[model samples]
Target: MEHVGVEQFPPDKTGDAMTTALLHLENHYWTESEYLAIGETPERIELFDGSLVVTPTPTVGHQYIVSRLVVSLYEVARSAGLHAFAGLGIRLGPGHIRIPDFLITTELNFDDRVNDSDVVKLICEVISPSNASTDTVQKMRHYADAGIPWYLLIDPRSETFHLFRLDGDRYTEHAKAAPGELLELTEPVVATIDPAELLPPR
Candidate 1:
């Protein structure tokens, strides 16, 4: 996911973390507007089916993989006259908001508050340890429901990557690879990624 910079959370100041935890425990349902009004939160949060889902802060490993993938994908998208952004909030439908790890877009509006999935050619998510199911299963369904043409999932712990394409109302797996394998994709965007490079330093 995209971040301004690494935020150092000192142990003494745990208010934000505690509040986020409490909110999760309450299982509150939030509207898309409400979630958007909350700006610059201490926690990584998203709105799924009108429910607020809080995710743990990404680890260094996750950042490393996302950075490399973004760079690689950006090169391809830029050459194709498209823009690639990290951590942009996407509106999949009413009450459905997603912050994809990376998104390739054709729109140039910098002030766009919420980008509709129609212009999004590709969406990617680097699975975090705490929210594996959200990314792997829940988000996969959401993106499909939004009619996104392409979706990619990278798992740091498993050292695996998956690419999916929208088929009607569902997604069909197009390609998958483990570390040391090359995954080539075409259609919405064209690029090759070596899953091995996505692995964090040992």
Candidate 2:
């Protein structure tokens, strides 16, 4: 993937190249390969149903929760013979690629950059304010459509956790927890995390 000879655009600032690309790419119908060729942009870029979607850079609170989850879940997954990764692009289907905040798989195969759906056991996302709808709605639909067995959403603003188990073409709510509650996940991944521990220190 080439750099396209442009500085990565920050969430608050769009470089001329990015602006030009976004303008031209609108309704252009991009493929997952072309989207991956753009490399790492400051903003989160995803492909869904042949269109490109740019999401805002995650806030500190969002990253904080992701970090905490990694630390908390790694041991549990490892003890149970599973592997975990953060910010890994997953190829869901033709022209569909999603980068979960983190993912848990039965094994660690770092030989490939993008993982196929089969290896993914669980996909987790730390909801940012800028991406609430996309995370809660679009991503939920996409994950279920890809036949992912499990999906977890952690919303920092509300300090809540949501777990969804895939049932046929849709996901049924499996578990949920509010702040200060212990959220125990038994399938896909096994662990109990205190939702409050993921919150940033004031």
Candidate 3:
């Protein structure tokens, strides 16, 4: 199937390109090939089965938290010969893709823009208001279904963090921390995290 690239639809400052992309995508079942064809978009787009989940650009605060978390994770991951990345696509299945806010993986190279779920060791998502349930509920199920061993959820609004470890086919809460507490972990790379450090200073 021939898929159109983003260059075919010029974007204006008002987001006409995204609108054009969505209009063209409506009523169509997307495959990985077709989804990848629309590369380098300004918006974050994930595919579930044949559906497209379009997420608006993240706020500056969200990016700030993600950046800080990635740096912290990277220190431990690199020491253990693993790589930590932010906003990288992971292919959970044939038509399933998700871009976690941060990921730690054994795969050292990512020239293809997407990697298989098997290469992933842990997936972390910092909650955003617009997709709270999607992050806390839907993605929890999806990551478990993909056999991702560890899932970490950080909620900046709540100033909390929850870490889950896969047991059998589902994830069980392994550790969590609230404000003024520390979230420490041993497996999947050891690290101690203070939720307060993730937020911007006053």
Evaluated with lDDT, which candidate comes out highest? 3
Top-down TM-score ranking: 3, 2, 1
Q: What shift in Å separates residue 56 of candidate 2 from its native position after superposition?
A: 1.9
Clashes of each: 0, 0, 0
How far out, in Å, is residue 125 in model 2?
1.7
TM-score, candidate 2, is 0.82
Task: Predict model 1's lDDT versus the native.
Answer: 0.76
> In candidate 1, what are the lDDT values of residues 1-202, reduced to their tens digit?
2212122343446444211123523445566655665556767676766666666778888878888878877878888888888888788888877788888888755786677888888899998877788788888998998888989888777788998888999888889999778999886667888888767777
Q: For residue 65, what is the lDDT in candidate 1? A: 83
Give the winner by TM-score. Answer: 3
Off by over 4 Å in 2: 1-27
Pairing residues by index, what is the TM-score of model 3?
Answer: 0.87
Quantify all predictions' global Cα lDDT against the true fold. Answer: 0.76, 0.77, 0.83
TM-scores for all predictions:
0.81, 0.82, 0.87
- Output the better candidate (1/3) by TM-score: 3
